[model samples]
Target chain A: DQQVKQNSPSLSVQEGRISILNCDYTNSMFDYFLWYKKYPAEGPTFLISISSIKDKNEDGRFTVFLNKSAKHLSLHIVPSQPGDSAVYFCAARRTSGSRLTFGEGTQLTVNP
Target chain B: DTAVSQTPKYLVTQMGNDKSIKCEQNLGHDTMYWYKQDSKKFLKIMFSYNNKELIINETVPNRFSPKSPDKAHLNLHINSLELGDSAVYFCASSQVRDITDTQYFGPGTRLTVL
Candidate 1:
């Protein structure tokens, strides 16, 4: 079963615009959520993460919002740059779990 | 420096052949994991090892075995490989002691079985 789901397969946005990617999880046991950006032929790189205790976390232009009640999380990239074009994956870690469950990933293209 | 690294970025072999993928992390992390990205772009965890001890096994087939010679290394060996096993494999490492346990990934290895 897919514990985490990213319904949007792809998203396109103009550079300097806001880009939002959403993810939902079926398991309430997941306490930590993270976002990873992956480029072609490269492994995914960590972006931002939020703990269940917190509702929002921000770093630079990337922000992550977690709504525990809704079992949903989202990544917002403000002023999206062309360099931000890549596949973005949402991942979750169960309480005290060693492995991460990843979503199918959403491809984001930021056009200049 | 590369925190995580994998050897043989691409592998192509016959269905019946046996092959191995090696992973190493220089970050001195105690936990390492193997993840498979299939054609549908699903990244699923296969195995995880912490300090050379198996922590998670996601019900993978018996043909796939993970070996942790040391905390810094985790290798995957597949015997009698099948065409269905073709996919990109990624290695990741994290420090279990860290509360978040943020993992860093290596450049993936793509395997093609004919």
Candidate 2:
């Protein structure tokens, strides 16, 4: 059973526009959520994360919003750049757990 | 200076063969983990070790074994590989003392079983 799900397989957006990636989780026990960006032939790198207690967290041009009641979270990249094109994965960690459960990933293409 | 590194980026072998993948991290993290990404792009955790002790072992097959000689090195060995074993395996590390510690992943090793 997949606890985390990224329904969108791919997304396309124009450069300098906003890019939004969505993720959902079935386990309410998950208290921390994170986003990772991965390029071809490269490992995923940490992007942003939010705790279930908070609704949103922002760093630079990236922002993550979490809704505990809806069991959904989203990553927003404002003024997306070409370098932002990559596979984005949403992961979650259960309460007091160290291991992360990842989603199927969403490939985002930022067209210049 | 790569934080996490895995040897044999690509491996191809027969179904009945035995193979091993090595992983090391220089970031001085106390925890290590192994993850597998299947053809459908679903990433799943197989095992995790903290300070040379096994902490988490998912519902993976007995054919897959993980060893941690030290806090910085974790290796995976697969015996009697099956066709379903073909996938990209990633090794990651994190400092377990912090609750918000983020894991650093390696480039990944792609194993192909013929």
Candidate 3:
């Protein structure tokens, strides 16, 4: 079963615009959420993360908002750049921090 | 320097063959993990080793095994490989500081079983 889901398979946004990618989870036991950026022929790199205690987390031009009531989360990249065009994966950590469940990635294309 | 590295970036072998993939991390992290990405681009965790000890072993078949000789190295071995096992395998590591530590991933190893 897919506990985490990224409904949008692909997203296109103009450069310098705001790009919002959405994710939904069915499990309430997940306390930690993370976003990773992946490029072609390369491994995914950790981008940003949010804890259950906080509703939002921001790093540089990237921001993540979590809605515990709705079991939803989103990653927003303001002033999105062409370099940010890649696959974005939403991951969740259950009670066991050692293991993580990942969602099917969303391919984002930032047109310059 | 590459914090995490995996050898034989691409491997193509016949069914029933035995092969191994080596992974190493120079970041001095205590935890290492192995993940597989399928054709549909779904990434799933396979196994994890912390400080050279097996910590998490997913519902993978016994034909697949992970070996960690030290804290900085974790390797995956598959015996009697099947066509369904063809996928991209990634090696990752994270520090044991906070429960939400960030994981660093290495360039994935693509294995094609024919």
User: In model 3, how large is the Cα lDDT of residue B20?
Assistant: 99
Tens-digit lDDT track of model 3 for A35-82: 999999999999999999999999999999999999999999999999
DockQ each candidate and list the results.
0.71, 0.69, 0.69
What lDDT would each prediction earn against the true structure? Answer: 0.95, 0.94, 0.95
What DockQ would you assign to candidate 1?
Answer: 0.71
lDDT: the better of candidates 1 and 2: 1
Residue-level lDDT of model 3, residues B38-78, one tens digit each, is 99999999999989989899999999999999999999999
Prediction 1: B-chain TM-score: 0.98
Mind giving the per-residue lDDT tens digits that candidate 1 earns over B1-114? 888999989999999999999999999998899999999999999999989999999989999999999999999999999999999999999988644879999999999999
> Using DockQ as the measure, what is the rank order of every candidate, best first?
1, 2, 3
Task: Check candidate 1 and list the clashing pairs.
Answer: none
